[model samples]
Target: MEGIEGGGIGGYWWWAAASSAQLAWGINFYRKGYAGDSRFMPLKAFAVASLFVGATASAAVGILRASGVHSVEDAKEVGASIRSGLGIPRRARDE
Candidate 1:
């Protein structure tokens, strides 16, 4: 556990790739699934992608904030961005 040195930052890249893949899959699934077959699969894939993106952004923000690199306003902006980007309700702001 001391000399291990292959899982530092590359893990982020894998998540990114998987997220993108899920997003694409969702879109394609939705498009081809418009024939009224199964609607849940597309939504599931899309939600998974959104979750990954949101989680990554949140983690980054936390890391930055903890290191004295970001301000409170940044967190608010990120929250707003995530909500708007995901087409979520905008009236749920805490401020």
Candidate 2:
């Protein structure tokens, strides 16, 4: 009820959505777990974990894009001179 306190609506919304999604997925997974299929548990676990990780990464990318801090390309450019300064090994002319 306190209007816009501490991170405002955007932060709270993002946190709530992410957490609810995680809880729902966890419940559904446990409820449907295999009853002796042997390979089923491992397979399902992998799939669920992959889904969670992919979703989180996508959300992070979205936030970064919104902030206009797109990629490592900019950081790489800044460090390029340092990288080059380290120098690559040269082959002997006889080869």
Candidate 3:
């Protein structure tokens, strides 16, 4: 996979901008929902917010991999860091 690293700077900017827009729209949806402006919008508001969160977190890890964390051990350390940060259960073989 190319890790969203193509198209040079423009592509990176496009991705960042798009992610920001998605998050903004999600927040707007939540605001409108809580304010009772839309009766059926609260559920979708959570979905969109989670989507943005997942996408951004995934993108950050992808970026670290693409930017030259090449060695296997380095990758493992990165993974461990991620697991720890996310409070994920560590494997028995974890370092």
Candidate 4:
């Protein structure tokens, strides 16, 4: 999938979260591969990637929905607490 562009705050956070997840999965798969009962496969990898994307999108959407936010700016405000908690840099959410 096309990732967010220009390394916006949200985009950067998404990359961090997704990359971390992918890295963890890679480690898990490597370990499993050495275990002889590995279930790591291309389809499983795809599924994991899909799940990560879905989760990130859902989280952003959910924050927006929960806060009655209808725009990027609104999303920024709504995501403030979370973004701060995650140590993501603050930026104007408005495009």
Best candidate, lDDT-wise? 3
In order of appearance, the predictions have TM-scores of 0.35, 0.43, 0.42, 0.35
lDDT of 4 by residue, 32-80 (tens): 5543334656666676667666556656654444445667776667678
Q: Which stretches of candidate 1 lie over 4 Å from their true place?
A: 1-37, 71-95
Residue-level lDDT of model 2, residues 1-95, one tens digit each, is 34233323443455446755765685676677666778677887887776577557656644544444446875454356555677843334413
* TM value for model 1: 0.35
Per-residue lDDT of model 1, residues 1-95, tens digit only: 33123334433454455545655655665465444447566876666567556556656644454433346887677878888999987875465
Q: How close is candidate 2 to the true structure, as a TM-score?
A: 0.43
Model 1 is weakest, by summed lDDT over 10 consecutive residues, at 2-11
- Candidate RMSDs in Å, in order, are 10.7, 9.6, 6.9, 12.0
Number of the predicted model whose TM-score against the real structure is largest? 2
- Tell me which of candidates 2 and 4 scores higher on TM-score: 2
Rate residue 93 of model 4 by lDDT.
52
Task: Please give the CA lDDT of all the candidate structures.
Answer: 0.57, 0.57, 0.64, 0.57
Candidate 2, run of 10 with poorest lDDT = 1-10
Clashing pairs in 4: none
